[model samples]
Target: MGDENRTGMTEFYFRPFSSLPKVQLLIFLILLLMYMVSVCGNGTIVLIVCTDCSLHTPMYFFLANLAAMEICYSTIIAPLTLANLTSLRKATISLAGCGIQMFFFIFLGGAGCVLLAFMAYDRYVAICHPLRYTIIMSWTVCVSIVAASLALGFLVSLNMTILIFHLPFCGTNEIYHFFCDIPAILHLLACSNTHAHQVALYICSVINVAIPFLLICFSYAFIVVTILRISSGAGWHRTFSTCSSHLMVVALMYGCSSFIYLRPSSSYSPEQGRVVSVVYTFVTPVLNPLIYSMRNKELKDALSRALGRKVLHQSK
Candidate 1:
């Protein structure tokens, strides 16, 4: 009986839009389409960048990495979310499964934050100091930056996951949000002293989200000043075009993420949190490829040429 009770307590139930049974099918279909588009779009970006010799630069290299990260991030959460949405009864996950989800969610999220900052810095160098751009952002330096971002992301996420999951969950196994996240898990589920865990999460949020966001802001500040000094209108337009897509992505990602993570645990609203998670995890990935491809002529041309080559080969 004791073993049975312990096993029961270790399972978590997810309440995914439980009240909206009338529209559950619509919601599921929409999310499915979004997930498919997100995968295909990010995959195309990675493929185009890898195959096109002309796109073998620091900028496209980082873009491809970001695409891959989005694929992993979305895959970690989307299928589970869809499953829960489609179930007539409440959906449940094992404690171990929840831990895995939380770990990768934080991991990819932190990597993306740092990667965006690096991309901003890349743009700043290319536009602000055109002559020294190649020397400053060489292949070795770019690789090092990507490596550092991944290392930082995994280390921070690992630490947080260990701290949070080490707590005892004695009762109440229902998690209010769609997937297991740090905030929901710490605030709503844990049955022990979470004061220390809350403090640690706040610090992690500062390091992972606040610091990188500020760096991106500072880079753009300098970039704007440099562009203003370029006398020609065409130079101004060209410089703005290069940075616009990245800026849009940064705004969408950081805005949704900050709202979810950068608040006191007491202030967490499960409904609002789930809605924002959908935007950042599902919607943003689909939009990222469109933002980059639609705004940039170079990527469009590369994609067209790559597709055209495939068509010619298939016809032969």
Candidate 2:
């Protein structure tokens, strides 16, 4: 505790991934490949959404933003992690650095949750109320929704970061995981009693994860009802197809995050935490582009057109 008084700063060093000592190199290589692919894939999605005239619609617009978020969120964690892996995980981050990382990560994550719900609502409007979809989801409205999602994300993230970092963090000075996750920081690094903070964090998790998930479910229920009402089987298949990718993403994200955060802090095993963090943090981002592109015909078509234009121009 005197370390803070002496230096006027608190620094948290990352404890090595002790659970897997033998395979850090292999893990590094795999993560590097996955990170590269994720960046490229999501970058392509963003570029396509921006340049392709055919993709200038509400759904694609939301998808572009989602891709951008994945890129940023993953970048914030992956590069530093990869660098630390090279050193076998003796990474030190200052208090301010930790807070900034947490804030942006939570900001992007919170916004993403809300954005997914909005995408569901978008689909609901398109299918359930096609006649008014244009009026309801106009360009101005879409921009406002994005703005609001970001604003809410910013405020919530700011609040959580403030709540956690406001207290004096003293103890082992070692975070067991790669990044300063809320639970890891709260449980492992905090010097004082954090029961109140834990409770507040849990409530925030419910609001961030549960409410949006419920909204998605509600939107889908209407979408399903509307789909079933369609007289033709093809219509049923077509409508459902549009939602499958988003559902997969929702399942992957909500499932992994809920498993980590929504549970009691008593069960926070450093080993388990790191592994699960790998899933939601690294694995999900890499899969997102593949999920959306492989499932959606429009994205693939736009990609092909872009590639063809590049090849032809190069040949010239």
Specify the highest-lDDT model's number: 1
Q: TM-scores of all models?
A: 0.95, 0.95
Q: Give the clashing residue pairs of candidate 2, or none.
A: none
lDDT, model 2, position 224: 87
Query: In order, what lDDT does every prediction score?
Result: 0.89, 0.88
User: Can you write out model 2's per-residue Cα lDDT over 1-316, one digit (the tens) per residue?
Assistant: 2444236546777776544755877888889999999999999999999999999999999999999999999988998888887784487888788889999999999899889989999999999999999999999999988888899889989999988887666657888889879988887777778999999888888888989999999999988888878999889778877999999999999998888889889988878988999998899999999999999998999999999999999999
Residues 1-316, model 1: lDDT tens digits = 1343355567898876757876888889998999999999999999999999999999999999999999999999999999988888888998778889999999998999899999999998998898999999999999999999999999999999888877777657888888998877877877778999989988888888899899999999999899889999999888888999999999999888889888777888888887888899889999999999999889999999998999999999
Model 2 error, position 66 (Å): 0.6
